[model samples]
Target: MTPRRIAFYAPLKPVDHPIPSGDRQMARLILRALEAIDPAEIGPVEVASGLRVYDGAGDPAAQARLSAAAAAECDRLLSLYAAEPARRPALWLSYHVYYKAPDLIGPAVAHALGIPYVVVEATRARKRLTGPWSAFAAAAESAIEQAALVLCVSARDRHAVEAYGPPDQQVAMLPPFLDLPPAIDRSETASPPRLLTVAMMRPGDKLASYRLLADSLSRLAAQPWTLDIVGDGSAAAEVSALFAPFGQRVRLLGARPPADLAAHYRAADLLVWPGLNEAFGMVYLEAQAHGVPVLAIDNAGTGTVIRDGVGGRLTGPTAQDYAAALSALLADPSSLHALGHRARAHVEAHHALPAAAQRLRGLLTGLMS
Candidate 1:
């Protein structure tokens, strides 16, 4: 028999979206992982439905329109499947199902087709139910309830998903993984203690992280370190202004391709980003995979990525604590080198693509059967 086809969707960002960010990268990674799990060891399985109903801004009007479009799309898909049963998707797999970007189409389509539906990185918070995104949140919750499985990437997300998800819905841990090259070996520190940060310059948490980093680094002005920032977004001007005082010490390289960014990670000795309430920053893993230690606040999402004193330092959520941690690391070069070495090993042991592929295969094998 032909392999079961998986229809993949990312409401926040499509897999082929014309943007270079963590979300897009993750969507692509999931597609690769699923295709690799060709159940019969035949060629790669097919991923259907390239329709993009992006509601990244959480606009209710936009969501309603997208839902209507999704309904029509579902009708078309069902009609097409009826005409050619062999081409029908066996499963609908959605990536990043949350309030701001809910899977409005998948649940209805899957239910109509009587196929198994799965979600990756599905988050649930009670507070969102009564907020401006109440409708979106409710829709997201409904999707979670409809899903046969919820693949969580962080412990924090798993707790929320398990707490609020349908009692019968299977919740499994799928730790974040990356398509990383061989881990780099950095047994020695750079001469001036190179620092790196890779995050978008958007408002809210992204801008806040940049602000906190600027404030913390400003406090350590006496120290000699070069900071290279690799990201660009709506708040680029604001982000630039925050680091303007640092002058020559700071370099904003803007958004870079993965290869270029990896080179910077390899060259840098430390990666510092406050990572205020992130959904587990993939940049931390990328840096560690390149043998670069990170300094981030110990929060729900970031804590999962950076192991304190192992891959990097997890500081408290305060400028003083962050500044102190940076100062301490700069003062002790040997310790920094040792941490970098361990960081590489930690990523290689856990976050590589093969490990993720195996875990995904195990989860999807039963679904196919």
Candidate 2:
């Protein structure tokens, strides 16, 4: 039987290279997960640069022209998808479904081609309509209406999709899976308590999260812990300033290779992520695969990954709450070890890459049939 050709689409930049941001990492992980089953299953995955507004000190007219050029490029890609034969792709998969123009183009093309359109990590919150992202919310609603399958990462996101009144067969709760590297052979005693937080220091609210993380770590000055922050972005300087007081306690290792990252995960004991919001954090699974538990906030999509007291602890989304959780976990080494063991087992039992690939294959096969 011919394998169904899946056309993957990411509205943001493709994760072919190391970049800052969870979105890029998620895109890379999804591509890797599909490839784990069959390299040929995914065909000609394309990415469109979604609407990016630049408000810099540079010329405004040039920025406008640049934006126009980017939009035109997206239009050209959509036109190419439209001109392709209906049988070109057995299905179309989109990573995120909320960008206004660039992100909408691929879904629109998929709809035109009469292929099963699947969206991953889609959300629909009423408050979003009152924010700057209102245009994106409208586009997301339209896409949800046309999607054949909405693969959500959390119950909250799944509920949000159901609230939109999607067709019964069109929604799936597929948690993010991990294709982690082989666990490194390291004696736990040889290394200090390695705490990993993989994220880009972007110039936005994410920087605030980093600041909170640093503040939380400051409270743990007496603890024997070291943080290895991976990834780079626009707010690198600001993040550095936030971590400066920690001195040797914090290491800003910017954007290591994926292999290096895997090694870091294996050598680490815990992953700390204090971000305000996440669609679905694949890094948590990556850490768990390496026998490392995550310490994150119990908000939105994050709680789905870190089960309190089972694999790891989920605290309120605040610096003080994270600080308290981190302090207690680090203070008890034996508990940490047990939690790490349970974390690994949890991921193996639930979100193993092979199992996730099989699920995806089954979805594609059913769609094509």
Using lDDT, give the best candidate's number. 1
**Cα lDDT for residue 72, model 2?**
77
Clashes of each: 0, 0
Write one digit per residue (lDDT tens) for candidate 1, span 60-145.
79878877877787788788878987777777889998888778778988898888999999888668888578788888889988
Residue 177 deviation, candidate 2, in Å? Answer: 0.8
> What TM value does model 1 have?
0.95
- After TM-score superposition, the amount by which residue 213's alpha carbon in candidate 1 deviates from its true location, in angstroms, is 0.2
lDDT of 1: 0.85
Candidate 2 stretches with Cα past 4 Å from truth are 1-4, 17-20, 35-87, 99-102, 125-134, 167-169, 184-186, 189-192
State the C-alpha lDDT per candidate.
0.85, 0.71
TM-score of each: 0.95, 0.83
> Residue 330 of model 2: what lDDT?
85
lDDT of 2 by residue, 1-369 (tens): 434567776654555544545566777777766666654545434343344433233344644454566457557756765576433566777776553322454466566566788887776655655455555555557777678888888898888788875456478877777665565443452246788898877866578779888889988887788888997888999998999988887899997766677778877888998856766577787888888888988887777777778778889878899999999988887788888888877888887778877887676667866
